[model samples]
Target: MERKLVLQRVVIVISIISLLFGSSPVFAELNTDQLRATFEDNSILFSNNSEDTNCSPNAAQRAGDAAGELVGEDNLKKAFNYFISKGAPKFVAAAIVGNLYQESKGNPILRQNKGSEPNPLKAGGKYHPWNPSKPAGMGDAWGIAQWDPGVAVLYWQQQAGVQGDVTSLEVQLAIVWWQLQNLAPTSRKNVLAEMTASGNVNEATSIMVKKFFGAGIPRTDIRAAYANKAMSWEPDPSIAAAAASGAATNCSDDSGGGGGTISEGGLNEEQAKKFMMNYGENKNNESQKAMGGYLWNNCNGGGSNCVSFSVFFLNKFTSTKGVYTPGNGEAVVSYLRSNRRVPTGKTPKVGAIFSWNGGRYGHTGVVLGIHGDTVIVGQASCSGPGKGRGDGTQSGGGSGFIRVGKINETKAWLGRLPDEFAYPEVDMSAVANYVGASTGGGGGNVAL
Candidate 1:
């Protein structure tokens, strides 16, 4: 009799759960929104007017054109890379993300609601899509930028070419780009430069909040917090791109890092992370400070030099500190050729040291791993893009070590195609996931 009673109670509990969370009488389909809110953070962009937004495609759109929807940190990296590809400085990219995070926490497919918390990251009570005929009042806002009155969608719709997939980030961002460059009001045009050119990330965030997003209720502090976090994620300075190209103000393909796993050159992702925890980020600890001093004495840029950090990482990870290496990044390839007899080549391999020896110091970095066309590189330089031709280091307080991030594989990267990649002097020939060279040059060359 007791078991029977327990079964009845369990059935009742499940019925109640169904009423609240399941697709029962109360909600015809809550699961779809739930999946979208939780897993659909990247309904994403990349439409060639997808039959969508009418803005002329720029590098930002073209670079990310092949990417698909992703959530969390993945989305963050995509956004950062997208802006950097467009030649926006780190600050400009951060400002854009700051504004987006404020609006949708970086969710590309966000809709508005009339609830107390109108912009919740989850769909929840805020799943109201835009409807022009029945505006649905304040709850009818749409897009990552959240154009208001819900009726704003109508204006975008009327534009000749922007007709499909209203929720695509490609569509929305393209439209925003089009409006700013083409249709921005006089006030926006006046302040856009102030927002883009500000050296300080905070100042840029403030101007963006006031002039660009044009928020009815000001939240610069919160937006700036997100912006600052984005800034910290960068591997070099925004100005680093300027050094790479004749132009010193736009975006450049930066060598960046994030966490990755590989079993090559007697190194793994966790060990790479250990290197970062010990040497990278804004830890500002005594060890980091001391290492910075040591780097300054050796690499000549006070701990922020790429050669300094890459050499240090290779030696440490290979468990051979104070070992074979050159003074500047420019000599890394030759050093490998002469000393190690390992020829550097075009293809990137996990656990290889990549050198872009064209500029002054000729930037050098560790290839933590590779995913698709993106290469995760670790180097100490600026906090944005590496100055390809004139590649050098930034002074105090700028990000010097990037043990985890990613960069696109292009000749434009590191000023040109990597002169060559040097494998660490550890046994990786028979490792489970060991990667070999892809080039035709035969004999002793393990990986190029």
Candidate 2:
């Protein structure tokens, strides 16, 4: 009888502790288990006060419940808005939230707590420093996605100082978007396409879990259920569409009245900069390396060839038909002058191709940005680290790879796409803001 009384007291003390610190993993795990059970039974985890049991909860209602239990609703809303504002479909945003829910219970600062062992599987070690020069190893995972050391290092390197604190929801969300944009463009694009086509929350969540998170967790059913739960909370698609429309209008207004509208294929300075930066950053990417190699090998037929690389970016990003020629620098200038030229004396616009005299072929590169006298250009066949052929051979000058640099050594001729051409159907403002913030300034030269 005495031992039985002691056990009851101990149980009461433990229950009190659990209530006091609801964020404890012990409590979190317990709550998840109960939630899982509720899901399995097809019972509602939450309910309206009304008698309509059959009426499913909408996104706002579900979001409120999640806020009470996990991260605040405001943070989740910020993430959703960011994704939507950047052109992601609502379903895809919801899928990301679902993955975050499983990875860290929506806790941005949550770290892996496996144990006090040195091994990542065992947990409890110093978090890896955010450095990309070193290989990422199994270190204590941190932040919203529980990003392993390796992935975290790469992300940190890319964003550099913009990601002030890894634990902050703002930075974490930004990093997530950046990764989708740069590191996994193909997967991200495919997922967005699928979500747009199907508009199915379940399917989007499942695919995101498999591709985005690599099916990291074993509790696939629970994750899917959570994704469904998040779906009910997503902002209306019509609302986001309206916002995007308004943004486009604002962009047109801001670009002055006569330079042509974004919808009409006119490339603005910001849009052009964003495109050039992405190209420079991802030039050596697996998807782009072959094209880079082909352009290097075949575009000039082993002669001094830099014009093809510039033309490649122009054709890829703009609504213009890039000149296809194995021409010298003067030839490229002549081609631009004769075909849709923006005139020679006007200030060089962002996204304009700048041709400079070099040896026999001269040099050509895409004008990324022009800050006063400093003209930043993204060029191929330049000399620098990671800037040449995919096979480590130099093609034109320097390292012979795609790279960005500030040019002061050579006089340049400028050419722009026609003002009547429509810009790419993307939110250029968002891209501009993201790139500017990530790189620490608007005109600073970045490698990629």
Candidate 3:
């Protein structure tokens, strides 16, 4: 009886200990398992919601669902709004979202050695450089929507005040908007409309899949997989007609009255100026760096200082204007005169180029809001390392900016390179036509 009592006590003690300690994976909660499950379920849900007759739940829906899970509905809406505000055609955005759905199913996966899963991280070690096969993990590619590191870097640098890591989910949504703005249209709304007008969802899906993915994946499978899911998207009414008309669908001039408008091709004179103001506020600079960063990063291919910013902005605004290569100074000048002309002093509009050196090339920047004598300029630059290294006006050897024809508190002498430099008169209509041809692939048409 004494031995039995001892055994029973020992058993009770062990039971108590077991109850107190549970064993499981330490990081299960953060591993994103719950999100994965929810994503799978939503794919089926969306597939069933398609209005098109031929729409059926399949691989496309699965792909879209996976992609959707990465972005979520709320983020998706925000991304759509961003592109819409930037003058992206609704259909083009739809197509891009669809393409992303197909590629990696919204997972940020890049192939290194060859196309394979469970790839190791390239940047797992401190000295590692980026490689497609090996993922950097977490901050490398963090959501359903995926973007290149260069783009992610740019997004974080530009968007200020929003606290949190760029790898976080919320930041991914904002970056998605930026990604959509970058893509050139593969298909326009008219093409999709024409296909759908004949009442063939399968046909439309097949064509889009082929264009983006090529023969890598079978068309039938891609169409069936996404048929039902893709049909559920309802194009925003404001952009539906324009999309159908085969308008260039990407970041363009904003349509607000006070500032310039951006078309799908890029910003108009008014819109370009507004972009500067927005860029300035985001960069948190009260002086030339803001302008410099815009000019240099936009123009030159180097750092995000004044010179490169201008180069990038102008290149974006005028797609025909070649990039500022090391020996292409003369070429850049010729393009500016023949293809890209700026506004006159009388007009003094935003985005006008203040040329000097007898049209041999002086400097350029988007004119921010003009207030009396102070002409706000977004000068691009090639800043060196330091706190205020690349701010626009700290000129010597590095690229910078200066206001011509006037000097004040906001404006300073641009060293007076010359008095009356020639300004080219580029045809806006021709530029628009060039944009239409370059994007949307030859014939301009798309479908959602």
What candidate 2 gets wrong by more than 4 Å, as runs, is: 1-74, 114-136, 150-161, 184-199, 234-338, 341-448
RMSD of each: 20.0, 20.0, 21.3
Best by lDDT: 1
lDDT by residue for model 3 (313-429), tens: 455443334445412222333445455443123223333343333233444444432322334454543333312223333342223333323423324324332222122322233
Best by TM-score: 2
Candidate-wise lDDT, in order: 0.43, 0.40, 0.32
Q: For candidate 2, what is the TM-score?
A: 0.37
Cα lDDT tens digits for candidate 2, 1-448: 0112331221000110101112222212123334323222321112111212222122222111211111235666656665555445556667667777777776666657752222112222222232233223445775666666422422232221121333456656655654443233123322332332234566666766665566545466777787667666656444454334321111121122212112111122343444444444344362144235555455333212456555565455444453456365445544665564533322333445556554555566655444323444445442233332233122323222333223343432223221221122222344344345211111221211
Q: List the candidates ranked by lDDT, beginning with the highest.
A: 1, 2, 3
* lDDT digits (tens) for residues 154-245 of candidate 1: 23332212333445555555444444333332224323334443446688678777776678786888888988888777533443443222
lDDT of 1 at 74: 55
**TM agreement with the true structure for every prediction:** 0.34, 0.37, 0.28
Worst 10 residues of 1 by lDDT: 10-19
